[model samples]
Target: MTQQDRRRIAAGLADGLSYAEIARRLDRPTSTISREIGRNGGPSGYRPQQAHQATAQRARRGTPAPPRAAVPAEGTREAEGAREESAREAEVIEMAVRAGLPRMTARVHLDLLLSEEGRRTAAELARRLKVSPASVSVAVNYLVDQGYVRRERDPRRRRDIYVVDDDAWYHSIMIGSRQTLEAARSSIEAAQAAGLDRPVGRRMARAGAFLERVSLDMMESADRWRSLLA
Candidate 1:
C-alpha cells in the first residue's frame, strides 16, 4: 500500500465510507482495508504513520536486505521476491474490482489464484484475511453461484475447499452475455409498449439493437476462446 492509500483510508473513515467504498477508491480488496484497520487498533486508534511503520517492520522481518541499487515498487514490494508476486496479485484483484466485482469476492478469487495447492479451506482464507468465517462464507458462496469457483470436499482433511480454474473467466463471460441479452429483450419490449414517438423510441431501439449485437458477439467470442483453451 502507498502512503497515499493509507491517507485515503483515514479520510474515508472520517467521511463514514464503508470499507467496500474505501477499497474501491484505493483499488484494493475490502478485506485488505478491514484487516489493516483491525490490526492497527480498530479504526479509532489507527494512525497512518504508525501503520506504515508497522507494515515496514513486518516486511523487513520477512524479507532479506535489498541491493542498494534496487528501489521497491509502490511500497507494495519489499526486499523479498514474494512481495513482488504479491504486488502483482493485488493488481489483478484491483482490476477485477474495477470490472464491477465486489471487493471481497475479488479478494477470494485472488486467494484461490495464488494458492499453491490450487484450493484453500474457508478457515485458511478467513484466518489469512483477518475476516470472520461468515464473510469468507458469503464471498465464496457468491463466487460459487456465479460459476467463478467450485467447492469440493477434501476427504483427507475432512473439509471443503474452494477451487478456481483457468476457465473461470469463460463462465463469467458466458453468464454475463446471457444476462445482457435478457435485459436487452426486456428493454426493447418496454420501449415498444410505451407507444412513444420516433424520437424516444428510436433511441431506446438503437440501444437495444446495440445490446443485442454485443450480447451475441460476446457469447460467440467466449465460445471461440473456450475452444482454443480446450
Candidate 2:
C-alpha cells in the first residue's frame, strides 16, 4: 500500500477505530488493516498514531528491502531501515550478553556510549537504566571483560567510576586478533601435517597466513596509536 494510505490507517487505528471501520474508510480489505496493525504493533496495545509516526520515521531514514516481501510496497525503505536499526540494537545487546552482561547491563553500556564524558558511576547508571546498584555492578563488570570499559576507584567518592576510553575498540580488536592468529596457525599446521595439499587445504593455509599477517599489522597499528595517544 501507499505511504499515505498506511498513515491514514495508522491514524485511524490510533483513534481506536475498528478494523472494519478503518478498512472502509481507506477502501481496503479489513484483513489488510488488521495485518498492518498486528504486524506493526502488538495485539494487546496497538497505537495507530505511533505506528504511523514509526512508518514515517523509517521512510525518512531510507530503509532497505527486506529479505522477504512481507510488507511489500508498505514503505519498504522505512521498514528496512527500522529492521536494520533494530538488528544493530539487538547486536549490541547480544554483545553484552556474550560478555556476561544482563539485559539491563547491556542497556547501561549503550547509555554510557551515548553519554557525555563516556563514563558514569554505578549508582547513576543504575538509576538511569532503572536497575539496582548490584545489577549495574554486574553490567559494568561485563563491559570491563569485553574491553569496552574500565573501572577506577574514585578517591573523592566512595563509589568506583567506569570509563570508556579511546582505546576501547583497539583493545577489543587486539584481544580478538590474538585468538584468531592462534587458531589460524593451528589450523594451517594441522592441514599440512594431514598431507592435505588439495585446493581446499591450500586455500585454507593461504587464508590462515593472510589472517596471521593482518593480525600482526593490527597489533602493530594499535601499539603505535596507543603510543601516540600516550
Candidate 3:
C-alpha cells in the first residue's frame, strides 16, 4: 500500500474508527486494515497518529526494521557496514529499474559499482547475481563496450574485474543524447522529404528541432566539464 493510504488508515484508526469503517472508506479489506495496524503499530496499544509519525520518522531517516541475522555476529562494525552498503545498493538497483533499466542489468551494474573493493571478478558477480559465469562475462563486456564500465586484470587473482567509475552517469547521458539526436534528425529529414504540410509533419519538425538544440547544448556542457577537469 501507498504511504498516503497508510497515513489515512492510521488517521482513521487514531480517530477510533473500526477496521470495517476504515476498510469501507479506503476501499480495502477489513482484514488488510487490521493487519496493517497490527504490523505497523502495536496490538495492545495501537495509536494511528503515533504509528503514522513513527513511520514518517523512519522514512526520513532512511531506516528500515533490522533484519534477523541467520547467525548473530559479535557486534562487528564491518559486518554492519557491509549490510548497510548492500541495502543501499539494492535500493539503487530498484530505482534504476523504475527509471526504465532492465532489472538484471541494473543489478549487475549496481553490484559492480557499489562493491567496497570497487570491482568484482566474473565468478563473484555470477554468484551474487545467481547467474552463470558466462552470463556475467557477457554483461560485463556489454557494459565495457558502452563505456559504463572498464575491466582491469587482477594480477594476484588472475581474474578480470569490472570497474564502474564515478562518472558513469555522465557518459551514459552523453551516449543517450547522441542516439536521441540521431533519431530526431532522421525524423526531421523524413518529414521534410515527404513534403507533407500536415500538422503531424510540422509537429515532428518542431520536436526534431528542439531535440537537436538540446543535444548540442548537452555536448557543449559536457565539453566544458571535460575542459575544467583537464
lDDT of each: 0.75, 0.69, 0.68
> All candidates: CA RMSD in angstroms?
7.9, 13.7, 12.5
> Tens digits of per-residue lDDT for model 2 on 1-230?
66678767767645645556677899875655555654564322455566667667777988731332344354588765655554455456556555665556667778788778988888878665545677778778877876878888988767798988777877777887788889789878866865566877787788778888988898888887886545
Clashes of each: 0, 4, 0
- The parts of candidate 1 lying over 4 Å away from their true place are 1-9, 12-78, 154-159, 196-198
Tens digits of per-residue lDDT for model 3 on 44-135? Answer: 24555666677678779999533323423536876566545544554565466567765556768977776897688888887655566776
Q: Which model, 1 or 2, shows the larger TM-score?
A: 1
Ranking of predictions according to TM-score: 1, 3, 2
Clash-forming residue pairs, model 2: 14-48, 58-78, 63-77, 63-81
Q: Which ten residues in a row have the lowest lDDT in candidate 3?
A: 65-74
Q: Given candidate 2, what's the lDDT at residue 119?
A: 88
| Model 2 bad stretches (over 4 Å) | 1-106, 132-138, 155-159, 198-200, 227-230
- Highest lDDT model number: 1
Give TM-scores for every candidate, taking all chains together and pairing residue i with residue i.
Answer: 0.66, 0.48, 0.58
Q: Which candidate gets the maximum TM-score versus the true structure?
A: 1
Candidate scoring better on lDDT of 1 and 3:
1
Clashing pairs in 3: none
Comparison by TM-score, 2 against 3, better one: 3
